[model samples]
Target: MHSIAFRLVAEEEEGRLMAQRVERRKLRDTINPFELPQSLFEKYYRLNKPGFQYLLDVLTANTEAPKKAFAISPIAKLSACLRFLAEGGYQTGVGKDCDVSNKESCM
Candidate 1:
């Protein structure tokens, strides 16, 4: 009976340690220079992506939940569009997805 109690406590402690590790990784990943939003980045336009991903991770994780109409800054939108163009896919797909206004040049 005592052994069971000790095991339970140890297991709980182990879980806590694992959670800490995960948080640390999350924090480290966010600090990277180019982190972009995952929802935005996953659309395959990710060039110089790691840094964008890290920034997005940090921003989103640190902030309050956004509204459905969440808007990215214009510069980021342009950058994302450019990345899409360089990668040979239309920004329209990502734009339609995020419900963003399609830039005329993307088509």
Candidate 2:
């Protein structure tokens, strides 16, 4: 029947859409925040290198360890947080700056 054929076509379309969604999701490339020049780092994070290192050291134990291989590192998380605070921008913008694809990760 035409209804049965339409149902099959719908299922095929759904499968193709799922494949496209999967293909679009990929691990985003990240940059090392610590590798930035000291001035640029301070400018973005509003903290000097030593202060940032101290904060990172203090917070490292409190931060959740990455469960997945592609999970963001604590350093990146902190950098994103500080950047968000310093820049007063949207989470997505901060995520892009931190190379985090997930805006929630920037939070």
Candidate 3:
């Protein structure tokens, strides 16, 4: 009886450890809009650098992530939004181009 009880407790502990384990996610690579040439940047996002900067400044507060680790930058978020608007593609496709995950794109 004692051996059976010990085995059950061990199983319970194993289950708890399994429950606490988090799945590792692959971090997608995001494009840097600033790295693009002026014409390309305008063509992709439909906004000039200055205009994009202005919008970023205006929307930074709302777009900023609370934590830096594993958090997307405000610029990346804005670029994703602009790219979505400019291309008029499905969110997943645009997000893929912008290096955003499908789950984040849905949000």
TM-score of each: 0.31, 0.56, 0.54
Ranking of all predicted structures according to lDDT, beginning with the best and ending with the worst: 2, 3, 1
RMSD of model 1, in Å? 14.4
Q: Report the poorest 10 consecutive residues by lDDT, candidate 3.
A: 21-30
Higher TM-score: candidate 1 or 2? 2
In candidate 3, stretches whose alpha carbon ends up further than 4 angstroms from where it belongs are 1-30, 62-65, 90-107
What tens-digit string does per-residue lDDT give for candidate 3 at 1-107? 99999999999999877665422223233346776779878887889999999999989755545575656567767887888888887564444453333335434
CA lDDT scores, all candidates in order: 0.53, 0.71, 0.68
Superposed model 2: Cα runs more than 4 Å off: 1-29, 91-107
Q: Write the per-residue lDDT of candidate 1 for residues 1-107, one digit (tens) a residue.
A: 99999999999999999999876544333322134356655554544566555665666676766455434443354455555775677655544432332323325
Least accurate 10 contiguous residues by lDDT in model 2:
98-107
Total backbone clashes of candidate 2, pairs 3 or more residues apart or in separate chains: 0
Residue 69 error, candidate 1, Å: 34
TM-score of candidate 1 versus the correct structure, residues matched by position: 0.31
